[model samples]
Target: MGILEKIGDIEREIARTQKNKATEHHLGLLKAKLAKFRAELLEPKSAGGAKGEGFDVMKSGDARVVMIGFPSVGKSTLLNKVTKTQSEAGAYEFTTLTCIPGKIDYNGAEIQLLDLPGIIEGAAQGKGRGRQVIAVARTADLILMMLDATKSRKQRTLLEAELEAVGLRINTRKPNIYFKIKKGGGISYNKTCNLTHLNERLVAQILQSYKIFNAEILIREDCTVDQFIDVVLGNRKYVKCLYCYNKVDEISLEEVDRLAHEPNTVVVSCEQNLNLDYLIEQIWYHLNLLRVYTKKRGEFPDFSDGLIMRNGATVEHVCHSIHRSLVENFKYALVWGTSTKHDPQRVGLAHTVDTEDVVQIVSK
Candidate 1:
């Protein structure tokens, strides 16, 4: 009768049920219920327990990336090797009892790298400080899933499951499903393209399970029931995860090569100080950051200190980042970069900025 029990039962049912067109609706409803129960399980108790200690580190830098894996997987070692901050690196399990923060400055951007405590199997169920670790993981811009190259591949699978159970969709994009809850109209289901996984009936059943009687549903792409569940919950973190396999020195070259070839995977040996630079480069790439240099009217642009901005940032964003009051002055920006057809082209607040662009804001 508990939320966990309900979630387990639904999961078992979903696993045992044969996948067919006949059972699609049943499966959809079951997944919706499972998501509901999981959400409830994660809700705070009425007793209002004190939060875990050392997990409240203030977020700094342009982006945050958290190291997550089982203990003794070289998370701390990697953190210590990459960043100036020294996290305790040990050969024993649970060496890191709390969240440890470090900083990495690469390509004019400051990245906050956190070495989180090891995550256990039942992390979603709040086992072994799993809840606290996962709570911090959700806040990260990227997840550095550190694994042991010497260990079996099961570690990666289990870690993925634990994070997946908690609504962390790694290296994945959000489902292209347009869903809106209407006040009075009945379900208006439409699809732009052919959807093989979901139909109007199954969609209606899934929506009704969440007590959504009136809604507008537009299926833009072919997505599964679980993805639809994620859309309905609307709290899932679709983050980019880089699978970092440490201790590659202990593994065979063939094994190391295989891991390195895997998508979004990096193989490194923190103890041997190998491939750490490339790992940092990959982190910068996946973070999707941009550096824009600012110029005064007469003086040259300070290329030494470029303004770090996110990808797809605009002139307005640049103004706000420089100073909140800059936008209030109503100015135009002179952009000199690949983004402009001519050198130092004048643009408005809506103009998107590119990496290494020289921006000079002219106020009215």
Candidate 2:
């Protein structure tokens, strides 16, 4: 089911539990969680759920979206441009001190866009705060690695190989228990990072430089680079990266052209504001979300309490999202969107609504 439905279901369950005096106490806490989540969903982009572990809100699917890149690239710049988020977009290295997020309208859907601290050389080996880098990478749905167009192939290649060796993964079941970085130097075969530069550039070279260490944290222990490729390309749900080759203005035309066709990427120059519009459009297209509106009427739903939803969403998702009991005894939703009477066009529990559509659901 979609997040809207899930939220309704949560709300429904919360209501049902509230009826039982004994469970009311526990229900209250749950309600708070869902309410906060609901608010996060309704709030503008960049404002997200409560930090760390437990039931946080989700967009299309569960995976959190993350943006990655070498220090000094335009990761934050892109975040600001796309989400309208004011991420500290500076020209120096390591400007992003922490993970920041911004929300934007993507064809009417909502997705979490996270900006992580830039990865530095030796990140996997505890350089430039490697642990934190992996921590953020672990929580990402899609990873957008920003490669500086001005940097030579060798410069990019070395960092790529190191990241591969570190093994990017996160174990949700454990509280940062399974995270680890692999060690590498010589052309030897190690469990962490294997090196056999025999095959060279096209395939083997990439394998040597792009493979993950032991990604058994969330994925199968046997997962391969092809699987990682799938995850980045949006097969796992979130769009791989709407790739951007930043600093294009500084690089030669040939380099910019090379980056444009390099695997999955788009060209942009933050300095010159080159092709930024196209880049934003690319992000919007990949996300496929539409803009929806929320309104307050008379004494509208206690949205400040954080248990409301957009017009098209059903009572069930909201209820379950609020608390599980509401779902168990969810009578029926009485809603009014676009008008006070009620919308015959308004679908039932599993209906999808659009932006600016006003709705109210009356439920037991």
Candidate 3:
């Protein structure tokens, strides 16, 4: 039987099975099996086939964001409106067949925005270049999950599921589980805290399903079976996503207010230019970027433009971002901002810097 058919059968079985303390281990094994089969199906075919157009786009900017949704959901329009890029927008579906790139300059940071081809149901099964589209999204710093205000909410669910199937965990943090494989220690399990959803036996069964016989596992937080499997697989992308409900001008104020209250949701009308600035602000906030100004010896700090870094960035990270050689040739950094103890406090490469911090690198 084909891999998809087998996967379908297993999914049905899982659905039919009852969940209980006695059956938890069995269910965990089934989930692990399903994940393994899906991974196998996603692997490239060994048999040579005709080469098709590739969707790989060179990433250019401080950060990259991609627009993803069903066709005719105003992804292209929003891209054009915000970034001034001329991606064709139409009333018909599938108007965008390729990746269209644009740049959004906000607060001295350049963010790359990509308008990807619309995704449909069965995308995870390689239907209609859906895999290619998702592959591009895997590299993004953030995903803009656009939805038409008039469309059914089922579209959003389908899009999220398809992305999840491809190992994209949206708006999720990495599981607080430390997993290591040993040559022959016989699977040791440790938990720093109580596990509300998983037990040791079920975790062992799931690990065995992946052929992991000897490993050390540590769980620091409450997590689910799927999360454990994700850690074991080790190819999942944990990314932040913004749920953008476009064409809000066509909807009622009550509807806009309702959507605005939803977590990580932004309601905007690209055609009417409504709430675009707020949307941009939310993007900047969620990206958690840090802007650091650089200064040379006995020179004023450059404020016109600053080096963009992710939150929790350190002086060592700054040096690496500037040039690899800087890390080796570096001595110390002088910081003049909230991260410093006194005015222009001298700090080492390990010193973490905050936004608007002025840094001067003194190297021999």
Off by over 4 Å in 1: 44-54
RMSD of each: 1.5, 20.3, 1.6
lDDT of 1 by residue, 279-347 (tens): 999999899999999999999999999999989999999998899889989568899999999997989
Q: After superposing candidate 2 on the true structure, give the runs of residues whose Cα lies further than 4 Å from its correct spot.
A: 1-65, 76-92, 95-115, 153-239, 252-258, 261-264, 284-364
Who wins the lDDT comparison?
3
Distance from true location, Cα of 259 in model 1, Å: 1.0
lDDT of 1 at 263: 98
Q: Point out the worst 10-residue segment of candidate 2 by lDDT.
A: 170-179
lDDT tens readout by residue for model 2, 1-364: 6445665677688767645546644453444344334433433366577743322223433234667777878888877776767999786888988767776544334556777788776665446655566555545555556777777666556655444434342211111112222464322222333322111122222323334332222222333333333332221222244456788888788867767886556788876788877765665544333333333335554433333243445545655555678566655544544432455343445655543444444345
Residue range with the least summed lDDT across 10 consecutive positions in model 1: 45-54
> In order, what lDDT does every prediction score?
0.90, 0.52, 0.91
RMSD from true fold, candidate 2 = 20.3
Which sequence of candidate numbers ranks them by lDDT, best first? 3, 1, 2
Question: Which of the two candidates, 1 or 2, achieves a greater lDDT against the reference?
Answer: 1
- Which prediction has more favorable TM-score, 1 or 2? 1
1-364 in candidate 3: lDDT tens per residue? Answer: 9999998999999999999978877888888999999999888666688867868999999999988998899999989988968999999999999999999999899999999999889989999889889989999999999999977789889999999999999998999999998999788999998887798888888888888999999999999899999999999999999999999888888988998999999999988999999999999998889899999998898899799999999999989877899989898999999998898899998899999999999898
> Candidate 1: TM-score?
0.96
For TM-score, candidate 1 versus 3, the one ahead is 1
